[model samples]
Target chain A: MLVIEDLHVKVGDREVLKGLNLEIKSGETFILFGPNGSGKTSLLMTLMGFSGYKVVKGKIIFKGKDITNLPVYERARMGIGMSFQRPPTIHGLKTRDLVQMCAKYAQNKEIDVLNLAKKVNFLDFLDRDINSGFSGGEIKRSELLQLMAQQPDLLLFDEPESGVDLENMALIGKIVKNLLRGNGESPRPDVPMKELKKIRQVSGLIITHTGYILDYVNADRGQVLMNGQLCCEGRPRDILEHISKFGYKECVRCLNK
Target chain B: MSEQIKIDRFKLEGMEVEQDLQQFVSKYKEELEMAGIVVNELERSGTYLHLNQNPLQCKSHQSGLEILDIKDALSKYDGLPDYYWKAVDKNKDEYTKLAASKVHGGYFIRVSKNVKIKDPVQSCLFIKDENVGQSVHNIVVVEEGAEVHIITGCATSHKVKSALHLGISEFFLKKGAKLTFTMVHNWGEQVEVRPRTVGILEQDAVFQSNYILLKPVKIVQSFPVVYLNGSGAVARFNSILVATPGSYINSGNKIVLNAPNTRGEIISRAITTGGEIIAPGVIEANNVPAKGHLECKGLILNDGVIHAIPELKGTRSGVELSHEAAVGKIAQEEIEYLMARGLDEDEATSTIVRGFMNVDIMGLPLKLKQAIDKIIAETEKDMF
Candidate 1:
């Protein structure tokens, strides 16, 4: 669903991502594990088309369309969605209004906004400004609520486990699991597993620092991004275990071979 | 009135608003209709009056509320109390002099002692004659233990290009009385408005004032003062102003705390697109055990310039006075944050502007708050 080839990105004068190559097919969930300052957020932001992250050399192909140079909103329209690490508080724009805006391009325009808000336990805050005075977990859940409303083809999450507590993490994990499946509704349990997977299949590139999200999201593959390059790929759990045991330096040492 | 006369008299002290008198009146009538200004007798429980440089019509249903023209009020009471008369005497300006010399239209409101007025008294004041100055001398007296709310709207039509509006308002609150005053102004691009307002609160009395201006005007300069003279008296001033292109707006308030334990707060929010706005505020604590706070926020939408100067003075060591003032463009991050939520750049900016102007003022009556909110929303929609 998304292709990033030979991507070289620069934030200001410093190069953050150099020659990064990545791709995610439809109905696939990819987990990116990285240490601090390892260019995990840069890739997500570049894909989301934030103006500050400039692409020097590379092509971002989304659904076979070149969107490397598109503005942020246009990228959003092209079905590319991102959950910011620190979303700024907008004073006048109500949360309900924002969710409605996200649903503008959805095939089902008449999405039940309050019900979506209720799933994230944000119904009371629907009338408030976006991210205004929200705690870290509240902000994350609010972002997730917008994504559910958007129902985008590709979802980019920046560090879903960081700063989230146990309770919030469980809720976020469940939501992320449903999001990957492309539906947030409770499974009838009577439905067959294959049919559910087909209904829930969505492409997602998620950044996890604690790897706590692995317990919730059934990620198909895992990749490690270190120093602006992809150095390893394997099962998400195995890659996470390898990093936990040896640290990212061991990956660099193995790459030297 | 066919000929335009550049009369040297009543030229206003600082700004100018004058065109042809007949044409101004005609244009004003059209604007009055649009503003829903009823000129005929308004007989209802709550008083609703219209003023066109004079008290054109007045209807009072409640026996406790006495609405009268300035002349009738003066003659009926034999004369106003020396305290309120002195309040008007304090403003020594050319416009005040013009208003005193030839008072055209103004209201006298008196709430009887211990009477609680539930329904608000509404008034509409408009200016029609360019050559004919529209000067009003208004007085509001709430007796001891009384409660009342007053809503006054001042406006001018499109064709009434130029005209001068000078308003001299004085309010008095007796012991244990409460008064809430709300004023809305919509003036033409060439209109010059100079309003002199003052309020005196007695012991344990409360006074709240709300002012909103959204339309364009050539010039508007106002600095109303309130004196918390009695112990435990409270005063609050809330204002929202939008100065459109080519307009010069200077608005502020000054509150003096005289009695121990008196409290005051002044909050002003201003938005300037391409106009020049100067928001100045002053709060002086003259006695120990008094507290006052001043906050001014200005939003410059385009190339407009805004100057926010807040001055706080404390006389006694036990008094506490503080102020905060800021002037800047809307944060780009805020705009982009909204845009990321699927709004275009313009929609995002407008939403932020609407939010910036949404400064919550406590104790607003639900009806008045809803009206103000609707007006603010409409203004935001029209602005962008």
Candidate 2:
């Protein structure tokens, strides 16, 4: 479960996230949509406990506990995971090392190195530095790998569909659905086997920018975040189609009203 | 403290095993062969690396590293090259040696005029002793228009008391010739290390070298000098060292550019955690068309540690020489961030330390750089 109550954020003198409030229960998939620099990343980074963003007023309750002031890594330790919009390319740390570290932190389990790599086509890059020279799609998939390894209770994804190709997008959607549906088994990727059958293990709060995820994923609810505030709530497709036709002009009109 | 400033140092009897030297040479040979370079029994030319007449040699478009060394290549040379020699010197002219174990510890390497070799020649100097002495005299000469790479690594295998290494390297880079020398020092605890090195660059020639010192020693006094004597000659010196816990390393590099359109760079990074490190490096360009730079960085990991006294002296303003020095410590925020991510304090510290020392040994051979990293890491664990 995830809850945000009257969140107020500011970068320098300008207020970004203005008293935003939202809630999502366990097993519920929610999509947050916003225009460029419309405080989308600011909201996500604040939730991730990033520095430089002052959470002036807000209460973020995850799993029935208030964690509005926890550190990024602390949040990550307590079953809260995030995939950065622009992930850091930490050199000298192999991809597998990072995944293992995440797994140990989130689940206290040592992930099978080879099995983890085979997921999302990163077997050849297991020993490579995390995103050191990865392509866009590769970076997204690697982030997905880390998320899978973390197996957190609440996962916040920042623009997962921005940098991936169509095939990778489909794969990410299928993986998320499978993981959420309780299919937490690494069914030897080479040969067909029984799909991981567990359901509703993770509740995902994802950010979709271009209606790309709507084409592949069916979310429970959709929220429009703008100018540091939640401007509207509607179906994911309805919000996507409105944004496509009006290009945030309708949001501006509603804000003025 | 003894009044002996240790202006002169050399081991009377070395403890290095013969097999160690053979292993280093063998590795060097394998890499050379893979590059299509043939290392025969010194041949009549007395040149260990025959880049010109050897035919595998070609003119490089730019100056950087090319290949890392393979293992066990020196054994193929048949008991070292005939021309390799080592000696100690006062300043650039006088020689002094109270004792020496191997009068000839390394093979002599030379390049002829207008003949250039692409692959670098590597030498390993392992100081194996406890309360003993060792000395080596390495002589290198670069004739006009010739090029070469010289890499040397020094370490001790056994615990030793009162050890010393007095080495003098005299290099003559002739007209338009080039030479790059990389030296990594892994001296042991309770050891005294003193090295005297110099390079003389002639017209249009360039001489560049890098020195990396790992772990800590009671006392270390080594400064390599480069003197530009010909028109358009160049020289560069890069040194990195770490000192912690009662260790004091007084080391730096110096370059004198006296020619027109000549260039040189001197960069050094030193980290002191518990002891003191005094580094005052200088780069002096004495005439027109000369350009040089000097940078010295020091990081302090713990309190009660002296990371002070890092200075850079740049002279000859019209010659385009700039020098700077800095001292810092690891931030608490950085540590806390990493620790929150499930890594313990020690693991995070080691990770940061290892990351800090990943010098871009780009032009150096990959295997050679990896070997150096491993040695540095090993020494770092001991220091901690």
**What DockQ values do the models have?**
0.60, 0.16
On residues A51-75, what C-alpha lDDT tens digit does candidate 2 reach at each position?
Answer: 7778899799988889898766667
How far does residue B317 in candidate 2 sit from its true spot (Å)? 8.9
Choose the strongest candidate by DockQ: 1
- TM-score of the second chain for every model: 0.87, 0.72
Give the alpha carbon lDDT tens digit for every residue of B1-384 in model 1. 011223253343322345344454454654543343333314223543434454655567788888888777788777776534567664487667767776765888889999998867777777654534577888988999999888787887556678777889999999999998878788888777888998988899999988888778878889999999999999999988898888888888999899999999999989998888888899998987999999998888767878898999998899999888889988877777666656678877877887777645545555546555666776776565
How much native contact recovery, as a fraction, does model 2 achieve?
0.18
Residue A59, candidate 1: Cα error in Å is: 1.6
Model 1 sits at an interface RMSD, in angstroms, of 1.6
lDDT of 2 by residue, B1-384 (tens): 341445334435433444442353464553332222234522111222211001111122233322211112124444334322222243343233431333423334566676666655555554444555555555677778887777665555434445665565667777899888877766667777767777788889988787777766777777777788898887777777788676778787777777778888877777776766777677777777778777776777774244334333445566676767667765544444344454555765676566556566335666567666666677577545
Evaluated against the true structure, the overall lDDT of model 1 is 0.80
Best by TM-score: 1
